[model samples]
Target: MRRRDFLATCTAAAGAAALAVVRAGQCAQGATSEVAKYAAWRRFADTPFGRVAYVEQGTGPAALFLHGFPLNGFHWRGSLERLAPHRRCIAPDFMGLGYTEVPDQQDLSPQAQADMLVALLDRLQVSSVDLVANDSGGTIAQLFVARHPARVRTMLLTNCDVHENCPPPQMRNSINAAKAGTYDQKMQRHLDDPVYARSEKGIFGSAYMTPANVADAAIEYYFNPLVASPRRKAQLNRYLAELESNPLLAIEPALRRLKTPTRMLWGTADPLFPITWANWLDQALPGSRGVRRVEGGKLFWPEELPEVVADEARALWRV
Candidate 1:
């Protein structure tokens, strides 16, 4: 049997005994060549977390993709586009935020995000998989391995918190943001505040700043999600709650000890996660490389420059 089929068959059997019936089916589904070959809405049952939304495609060893704050699996479409041909790629929106909803879901903490990742992987019937995480996805990736070291094979960390010794630009903004009361209010202040006024423009510009490419779609696509619900203002408030944990300060010590093979991918022009941490991590984390400095992009490089992101990530993973 093919490696994906052989492993998936074993994983499905394990999942059947470990996960609920629905989830086992999804794992079976994940291993299903006909089903996973196309873009389809997928659901898993009995993950440690509640029900979830997932998209899967291709075949072979799994490559699980995770997104950053305020964005869902949609953020991974571009990256998946390139990878689906050779690898089985799965991307899911974080719980309570995306197409998946857990109204009573409390504790939107980083640890919870990590826990959910483990459950999701188990339900999908993937024993071990590489990860592609961006921003907070990067943050959650560490917690995932820290919590379930056995599940993560290797990681491609892009502009994320890999080094506790260094602080990225967004971490500073997140701290400044918490004081603004509501999540929306803080980011609003971030956008409106004079300190970031020019930077905010860059944030949008980085989305589509190539020569002769004047596109506003990048900015619109990102901002439209916030306005998704007028009442979502309450939903927006939850992200700021992360402040109570001081996740960055808390996780910094652990980053230095990560045993996973990691690739620090950064956008050279990223205002949020400046390229400085690349060097800091290189000096601190053994075997880590400051590969391609992402050229001309924003915090949302996955969408804006998936080819660049994938090309470098592919090189890093040697996929």
Candidate 2:
């Protein structure tokens, strides 16, 4: 090869490599900016349960987003950014999770979580909301719909507990640890080790699509407050232990009788809550529009694929 041709090819390769590096840096910067934005958006609403921490954006009819276990309002950060232009987006950290402050004797049962949501909406003067939820939040969403059928304008449910499958078989070990008062210790280990937090033994591996790709900053943001102190650790355990009871069984009748328009978005790959449960929800709810299968999506797909959440939500809300 000619010397001039060799030089030209080498220069071109270096330029391409440099451009790739710049693009990668830009993506990382964008994610960091999003995390910072969520931190800045945090606000607290005084409810009977506690000073409920939440993030709100946009201006229009209200839309409530409920997160999964061990996750807070930040779970819906991507969806919130996308849907803010269409409706008022509110995502609150439930008691025993995230930044919500609860009284020393506060109940962390699913029922209490549902009631806390009521208190929160009332505090915000939001009479009704387009509800969106995932994991344990979906369980609370059902209870909320059963108790206050008139309050939910429309519901969009992702992979979550349905009927008798409250805690699921896979979570039995964690619940047992909670019952034995060792679950909090396990959480502490996760907090101390980011690599483990994203490993097969931790939440990221079990719930997320790309466990290793999860940001360290996000892991800290989630687990830090949960294991912040002794009281916080106890509260975290209580939250898990409370899930042992089958609250959905009793609400089955009410769920069937419910007339609120609903949509189910299921992640087919989620082992904890299978697509079968989503189909069950579709069959049970009288007003169910149908189930939309998210192929290969795991339990926390809404966080990973916010465009899917926003698209389905817009279709359900008819906006």
Candidate 3:
């Protein structure tokens, strides 16, 4: 009970309590980290084309997420997780994207992508889906909606390709380079530098308003699979080469006639798919629920604004 002994014991107790508090904070933050999110939902299915990698969560009316070009199901990771509790959220990596295997002799055209998506849904026994799409996935979603309206319950199309504006002008250089067999080299430059990769005109630049907010894991999730092999590079090349404005162009008439209730969440500031395109979508499709413009939204609003996307989807389904 000496004074020095009691003081020493008190200091030790205080230090231990502080350590516990620090550890607790770390655990709380860790729960929402990129690794935790990526680990949450991962599955693969064998389709006719190849093995398709997807992330699925929850169990209710199916909400299938389709990602744009140069990205994969991971692009839908945040929104998928948010919507999972309410609906069955399925985000699949297409044949030439994400963790999916590419067919050797296949062209991977937009129609081919449409068929592949259907096959994916069939393999999973998904009869009908509330389709949610962004970027180039919007183009393929249009094809699917136009070609097989019966299987689609409703649709949410964010910033993406419509009509002959597939790839838009900003994205043409990469596609043209891919045709000339130099895409891999071009992409490598951005892949090498994380900062440059997310810049305004970079790979994911136009996608996000605040590029620094993007997780390194999200970027790697899209790049690692495609960059792992030369075959994947070729597959990506075939995907780009097939984008001649024909596939989506051919489906324009069907799109105008599409009756599946459609909603568009547009990023108004997106240089590639501006608000004008959103207006076009609203006017073109008779079934459109109309456009909801995000004032500072970019191409990657799903990543940047998952809650808004989830809220909009919930509203659509409630109707």
Candidate 4:
């Protein structure tokens, strides 16, 4: 069997084991329990924007992870745990997302998000880092590298937005819904129907090849923060609006000039960021390390293929 296929099988087996543990109510205290593990490594940092929550583990060279929209640092928890032995994995919830505090007048545009990431790193006393970004986090990472190339030692990008594709057509429906100010109504619709929420047609389903493979608790971690309040909902809308703007056009020239040793770990099945975007990124970012494809991988590959993600980062940085 292919490596990813073998890994996927292993994950399925582990999920079954975890479910058995959950049934026995034995997952509440063990360090090996997914629930306990996710709860343990969390911390809050006071940044200029607000309080940012991050899941940090291991210690050595820093591998800062940036997650896409509607998801937060929790998205990288699996990879962080897997890679903790070799690298310090720091996954922070971007401003107004995850457990981070949302300001009433927050500016969550990609550029602002990138700036906040830089500042957060500064406050943490991390002078340099290797970036691992996916989804909207990929957009933010690119912008971060373009604006502050020196701070990044290397970068690994999974499927994400680039250039005019911004939000991409497949993702437009959700973005339009958010922009139309219908976040609450739509979110409630999912909350009301657990079956649909777990179906392939649901939020998690649309991104993951096997939605059932993801735990309900993990799904909650992605959606609960967005529906925390109307103000937070507005922040979500603001972030969607930024997607429509041609934000990357301004930085294209700088990106083409970048030489930061970039690597691509693309999910072949992602509708939003098709394989073509991987080619676009490989060429656009002159620091291109090359592209690595994950067969049957979808948008939320980090959540599903943590070990592969870690291997790619290790390959690029020689960690």
Best-fitting candidate, scored by lDDT: 2
lDDT (10s digit) by residue, model 2, range 1-319: 9999999999999999999989767766776777788989999999888899999999899999999888899999989999999999999999999999998789999999999999999999999999999999999999999999999999999999998788899899999989887798887887788788888888888789887667777777888899998889899999999999989999899999998999999999999899999999899999999999999999999999999999999999998
Choose the strongest candidate by TM-score.
2
lDDT of 3 by residue, 43-119 (tens): 78888888888888888889899998878887776787788888888988887778887667765888888998889
- Give the count of colliding residue pairs in each prediction: 0, 0, 1, 0
Which candidate, 1 or 4, would have the higher lDDT against the true structure? 4
For residues 1-319, could you state the per-residue lDDT of candidate 4 as single tens digits?
9999999999999999999978645422332366556767778888888888888899988889999877888788778877899888899988867788857897888888988888889888898899999998988998888888989999999999888888788767777887888855665556666568767777777888787666656656577777778887788777776777767878999999999999898889888888898899898878898999999899988788889988888888886
User: What lDDT score goes with residue 100 in model 3?
Assistant: 83
Report every candidate's CA lDDT.
0.63, 0.91, 0.82, 0.82
Q: Is candidate 1 or candidate 4 better by TM-score?
A: 4
If the candidates were sorted by their lDDT against the true structure, best first, what order would they fall in?
2, 4, 3, 1
Off by over 4 Å in 3: 1-33, 36-40
Model 1 bad stretches (over 4 Å)? 1-48, 162-232, 251-254
Clash pairs for candidate 1: none
Error of 4 at 123 (Å): 0.8
| Candidate 2 regions with alpha-carbon error over 4 angstroms | 1-29
Ranked by TM-score, the better of candidates 1 and 3 is 3
Per-residue lDDT over 1-319 for candidate 1, one digit per residue giving the tens place of the 0 to 100 score: 9999999999999887776767646644543432234225555455656667777877888998888766567667778889887678998877645555444445567777777777777787888988888877777776776666667777787776544523344455654554454556533443344234224344343333441232233223333444456444444555545634545556555666766677777777666577776677666555465555777655667666788767866776686
| Candidate 2 clash pair list | none
